[model samples]
Target: MNTASPTRKPSRIQKRNRKLILDAALEVFSTHGYRGATLDQIATCAGLSKPNILYYFTGKEEIHITLLNGLMDTWLAPMREIDPEGDPLEEILRYVHRKLEMSREFPRESRLFANEIIQGAPRIGPHLEAGLKPLVDETSTLFEGWMAAGKLAQMDARHLIFSIWATTQHYADFAAQVRVLMGEADVEGGARAHLDMMFRRLLRP
Candidate 1:
């Protein structure tokens, strides 16, 4: 929580310690959730003392918020990459594939986000309203424009986005169940192929 002074650059040790705390906190919070996680657990996971964690972050909530804020940028990157000028169907399919890739590669992060959202995003609610809402509104308008132009099939743009999130994130948020059902099969590959076909058909003009 803004531990380092603004005027002075953080030392190499400070940088290393901060990274250790964040990486360890990600594991703890992802496994236990914000309510369940503790600074002691983060300290143990980081192999650092409790005091060390406190030095970097004010407390558990601060650490959790920092992680969520960083994750928000990562989570929104694919949506931000949506090009308004690109082919409507191709752009949407590309976004779907990118989202699936994130779920596969960052399962812990995905689950961490899912947990925050499911818990009503008490801490992150303001951030969501500020950051996420605008992006969604903009994307909805983009999708609506495409539909109006007959470039994409007519549908509820917001619900379409929500469906994309739900479908893609299921692979990560429910990874344990998916693994059990998939049983060593190529989960990401299958999901990508299936989602591509599904969205293509849905959005085809």
Candidate 2:
């Protein structure tokens, strides 16, 4: 009955090779998006043969979907942190920071995800309806409760969530435009102040 393989640590070489593949896939996918990227390009980026790359992942869609699925947990975590018991302003502000940090740390993942949605989210439809919709609904309820208690500025709770998303994700989704207008130095120190001011103004009670 005890026939299951024991959990084993990845060998150092395996870990390095895996990173190589994921890094290469990120670069290719981010540049060309899922529809445009090719397995050959991804393999070249990984310094491996296409067959070798396929060993790590079965095919292009697999790698693309895998990356998106992996990114979702981290993406959803901040929203889950919305504490019903926490001060409303602070709870939302903390959520804002978590989002901003994700933009800064995982801009490529952000872009890839955006590309998927920009294409009508063909791969993530059920996930949006099932996973994200519920979280948004729950969070909206919390926001409504805050408003009823006079804890926040009276506004549409769902729209408030949308606004927070739009503001925080702007840095990643529109990064090239932002850099073009705001310049490269902006991400270094400017984003933090810009976001803080934006949220503070929006959330002022």
For all predicted structures, in order, the TM-scores are 0.96, 0.87
Q: State the lDDT of candidate 2 residue by residue for 102-202, as single tens digits.
A: 88898888888788888999987778898899999999999988988988888899988888788778888898888898764747467777777877777
Which segments of model 1 are wrong by more than 4 Å?
1-4
Q: Candidate 1 lDDT, tens digit per residue, 107-186? A: 88999999998999898999999999999999999999999999999999999999999999999999889989999998
User: Once model 2 is optimally superposed onto the true structure by TM-score, how far is the C-alpha of residue 118 displaced, in angstroms?
Assistant: 0.6
Q: For model 1, name the residue pairs that clash.
A: none
Q: Note the Cα lDDT for every prediction shown.
A: 0.92, 0.82
